[model samples]
Target: MNLDQYLPVLLFIIVGMAVGIGPLVLGYVLGPNRPDDAKNSPYECGFEAFDDARGKFDVRYYLVAILFILFDLEIAFLLPWAVALQDVGLAGFIAVLIFLAVLVVGFVYEWKKGALDWE
Candidate 1:
């Protein structure tokens, strides 16, 4: 094979690498060199770190996070389904209905179990 055919590919690879690394190299060369206690200290949520870094968090925190992710993913699926509604026909509509019903049931179960309670 002629290597000339690969010239564009090689140029693309080199340019991609330069675009990715150029800013980093320039920052390191031109950025500030000062470090202070406040700048170097570990900061979190507007407060100083008071607990162990590996401390166990409350299960409610995880529960809420999981619920958020579940609904977020449901929205992701919904956007695509809506965009393709004309192409999916009745069968796809029914399938999404069932999916939504199941999600509603789970939501109700979680509500009754007080999993959504903050206190």
Candidate 2:
């Protein structure tokens, strides 16, 4: 392989790295070196931390968050599929319907099990 062909690609990579790291390096070298008691404190809100920083949270919060992401991504798949509906034809349409049906079933199951209910 001719190495000359890769010169532009190598330059692109080097420039990309410089662009990514240049500002960070500049900021660290040029930034102020000021660390007062308020800055060094564990909590910076001028109030002492009443509880441990690593506190245990209710699992439901994570469960709901995960469920939200799962459903959100699944719904996102519909956007491109909708845009290309004519090209994908009936088969794609039916496939999306089935996908939506499964989503509905999962949502209904979660709802019936009170997974969506917050007290």
Candidate 3:
């Protein structure tokens, strides 16, 4: 295999890394070293923390967040499938329909399990 084919990819990766790391290097070098009590203290919207930062939270919060992300990502697949609907033809359409049906079933299951209920 010709190594020349990979030169552009190598250069692309090097440039990408430099672009990402350059600003961070410059900021550390040029930024002032300043640390005050106000800056170091734990703050919450201009007020001091009233409770422990490691306080336990309700499991429902996490469950709801995960469900939202799961459904959100599943929905995102629709966009690409929609854009290429013409090229994908009947088989692709049926596949997306099956995917949607499964998504609906999962949603109904979650709903029946009281996961969607908020007290």
Candidates in order, TM-scores: namely 0.63, 0.60, 0.59
C-alpha RMSD between model 3 and the true structure: 6.0
- Model 1 lowest lDDT segment of ten: 42-51
Residue 35, model 2: lDDT of 75
lDDT of 2 at 108: 96
Candidate with top TM-score is 1
Off by over 4 Å in 1: 1-48
lDDT of 1 by residue, 1-119 (tens): 89999999999999999999999999999999897777756664434544467866678768988999999999999999999999999999999999999999999999999999876
Q: On TM-score, who's better, 1 or 2?
A: 1
Model 2 bad stretches (over 4 Å): 1-50
**RMSD of each predicted structure:** 3.9, 5.3, 6.0
Per-residue lDDT over 1-119 for candidate 3, one digit per residue giving the tens place of the 0 to 100 score: 99999999999999999999999999999999898776767663444544577876678878988998998998699999999999999999999999999999999999999999987
Error of 2 at 40 (Å): 15
What is the number of residue pairs that collide in model 3? 0
Q: Residue 7 in candidate 2 has what lDDT?
A: 98
- Using TM-score, rank the candidates from best to worst: 1, 2, 3
Q: How far is candidate 2 from the true structure (C-alpha RMSD, Å)?
A: 5.3
